[model samples]
Target: MGELAVRIEGLTHRYPEQNADQRALDAVDIRVRAGIITGLAGPDGAGKTTLMRIMAGLLKPTMGEVEVVGLAPIRDANALHLKVGYMPQKFGLYEDLTVMENLVLYADLRGVVGRERTDQFERLLDFTDLHRFTGRLAGKLSGGMKQKLGLACTLVGKPELLLLDEPGVGVDPISRRDLWGMVQSLAEGGMAVVWATAYLDEAERCDSLCLMSDGHVIFSGEPAEQIERMRGRCVHVRDISGNRRHFLRRALGSAQVVDGVIQGDNVRLVLKEGVERLDRALLAKEPDATVEPVEPRLEDAFIDLVGGGPDGRSVLAETTPEVRIGEGVDRKAVISARELTRRFGDFTATDQVSFDVREGEIFGLLGPNGAGKSTTFRMMCGLLRPTSGDAHVMGIDLKRSAGRARQKLGYMAQKFSLYSNLSVEQNLKFFSGIYGLKGQAQDRKIAQMAESFDLGRYARVTAGELPLGFKQRLALACALMHEPPLLFLDEPTSGVDPVTRREFWMHINALVDKGVTVMVTTHFMDEAEYCDRIGLIYRGRMIAAGPPDELKKQAADADTPDPTFEEAFIELIHRDDEARRKTEAAA
Candidate 1:
């Protein structure tokens, strides 16, 4: 190693407020060196964040050696703070303050108030590309810009070692790439950077990785080595006809299949170890099925380490009846938006958006942060009224009667919008009541939801206190309580681990198989691949709409032959941005 930036041995930490002797980190050992980026990755409650805090001297480890820059973490914390830059999961940015104001405040807090401060501020402003938006309120910036601002604030003191906790949690792919680029540049400058993330793809970008689970370091080395172990085991299954979802369901259910994810028009399957090759028995029924080997990804290796998720089945669909369209509803266009427009003050949030979501299909409204997909989603879900145009759910005009349309819709907000103080059971009961469920029906639905999501053990636990996976389950259960024919999910799997993500999609695909329509908005480009069709929005306009494969075709250029979903998303967004710039120049 070049130089040890952080060193820990037999580190153990337990919160004074935690119930029992449950340690956040137990007998953990990790190291970070200068001039490289080290990734900290794991599922929720895996202690990645705890280790980061301890390294930054925010928490004193109960036992073991903890050193940063060759200095003790707790004994020399005052001096250590000057050499370290730590950004918690929730960066403390004053939303109402301007970008420059926030930067100035952070600089003052770091005692950088002089000519040196001015020079540092200018350098960081250019580094972060926030000069033009210096006067903009932090709250008014997009998710990406806010992250840049947060990074700029953290760099106020010019620290040598930087600790970032889940910096790309809700950021778009492009912004995430940009943020990573900045961090990479810092690493090149010999600053030790540690990035903790839930996204496996991000972990792959690091120079080295330390994968943790249950308060112990599972693997600490190059991510590629870990991924190499999963090679030759990854294969794609393609049906002669174009029913990838059905094939995915089957592949996931196979005895030999350990994990499967929908990729474009095929289902990528990871076979169990020692399986050598895909067995003909896997798709014996479909003689025309094609099986081709593909490269394994960090996610595949991650799933292998963490046990297999739900057994490729949705318990919620076990006892629920199949969705059936009632009278006066057009099955072809279960959800239709024509020239939809919504404005807030001087900004047009959704500008002349139009799309159609066919019955039994999972239609995604895909876009970057502040791209207006969520605004269009709100109009489509009847949560917000459009300034012009119209939206119809089940053929009912949203402009005329949104409340009536909502009776047939189940909506889940992007964040954990459910009551935090309420227990899981209480939230379920509240949502059931909100949907007008009553008496035996409400009781039966609650019981079914609890059992379906395997939330019986956590029924009495507060929604806010539950882990990330359990929170997703509770939110999904609440939205599904009424068993509406259409479900609207806003970033349903944000910040969740891969296993929980698989389970969530398994349930969604199962629901769609049963004829339920789904409309979703998500920042994850990979998750967008699972949608039947995508409405690609940018800057308050529907830039493109098609199946995931078709969208990739649209994104192909001279440089790329077959672009990944994230590449396609960025390409499409860049195209829109370039076209808009030309238009503005012409005007």
Candidate 2:
């Protein structure tokens, strides 16, 4: 390895105000070398942030040895400040300031004055591809743009070591690839980087990784080596029970199966060790079903270590009534947005965008950050009225009877919109109460939700204190408490671990099987497989709309015979950009 950038031994940290038994980070040890990307990956509240803060000298540890670039973080705090750049989980970008102003302020704070400051500003602006949006306020910038700006601000003085915490959260795959390019280039230039993320793909790209769980470094090695641990236990499974979803649910419930995830028409299964046979026992009665052995991924390994996620069957699905299918069910359009247009001042957020979500199917609305997907979603949910055009829910006019129409729907916001001070049970009770449930029925619903989501243990705890995965479960439970026929999920799996995402989608799949209609928006491209049809929105326009296989087939050509969903998305966006360039040139 190259020269050591950070070295830790027997490090332990516990917040003074927190319970002494609850150690944020247990005895941990890890090393980071210069000129390589060292990924720190773990589930929510896995002590990644605590370790980063300790390395940054921002927080003093309760015990143990810590050294950054051969100097102690606390003892050489002043000197360490110039040698390291730390971007916390929530980057402290001044939301009101323009991109240029924020860059300048960060540079000034870093003491990069005079000609050096001006030169650095131009360099970072170009590096982040934010030169054109220099005048845009940080608050107004898209999620991807905000992440790039945060990286730029962190790179103000070119510190030897760069520490970033979840820098790619909420960013689309294309933008994430761009950010990876930037970080990889920096690493190649001999800058050591410690990136903390929940994304397994990101962890796989790292030169080496430190997989933490419960504040302990469970694994510290290359990604491939970690994946190799689960080599004999992985396989790709196909549906044999006629319905893929049903077969998958059966497979998950199988004793031999450990983890199962939907990956574009196929479910990848993580089988138990020594279970090489894929007979009728594992195939749910279809002995002839095709089962292909495949390479395991870092995600499978991560899920294994974190303890397998929730099983395939949903507890809530048992009691939740299905949306009754009538003779016209197949022809029914549960959610119809016709020429939906929403404008703010002189700027149009969604430009005559339209799509129809059929009954009992998952319709995905995908777009780059700030591409007006949220705007369209809010308008459809009756939270925001469109300037022109309109939406209909269950054939009811959203513009006119939004409240009455909304009664037939359930919504789970992207941010897990729960009262910070309310307990898990309390939040469930409150939402159910407002949705018209009362007395014993309300109480029964709350108990069911708590049990279904496996949140009974945290029922008394404040919602704010729950982990990211638990919070997601709680939010979903609250939404389904009403048992509405239609569900609206906004980035329901953003920033969650892979296992958690599967757990969530499993619940969703069960609901869909029960004839419920789902309209979801997510940044996770792999999730496109779960959608019956997807609408690709870019620059406030509906660019493409089709099933996942159709979209991928459309993007296929000479160089790539079968492009992945993400490649299809990028290719479509690239073509649109090229066309725009041509138009501008012609003008």
Q: What is the C-alpha RMSD of each candidate to the true structure, in Å?
A: 1.6, 2.1
User: lDDT value for candidate 1?
Assistant: 0.89
Report every candidate's CA lDDT. Answer: 0.89, 0.88
Given candidate 2, what's the lDDT at residue 466? 84
The weakest ten consecutive residues by lDDT in model 2 span: 323-332
lDDT, model 1, position 587: 100
Candidate 2 on 1-587: residue-level lDDT in tens? 67999999999999875687888888999999999999999988789989999999999999999999989999999999888999886799999999999988988888999989889888898899999999999999988899999999999998999999989888998899999999999999999999999999999999999998878889999999979989988887764546678777888888888888766667778887678755566564666568888888898898888777667888778889867644543346878988999999999999999989998899999988988999999988989998989798887788999998888889999877799799998899889988999999998998998888789888889998888789988888888888998999999988887877887888899999998999999998888888989999998999999988889988898998888788999998898999999999999
The sequence of per-residue lDDT tens digits that candidate 1 reaches over residues 468-518 is 778988999998888899999999988877887888898898898888999
All candidates: TM-score = 0.97, 0.95
Error of 2 at 351 (Å): 1.8
> Relative to the unseen true structure, what is the Cα RMSD of model 1?
1.6
Runs in model 1 deviating more than 4 A are 16-21, 240-242, 584-587
- Model 2 scores a TM of 0.95
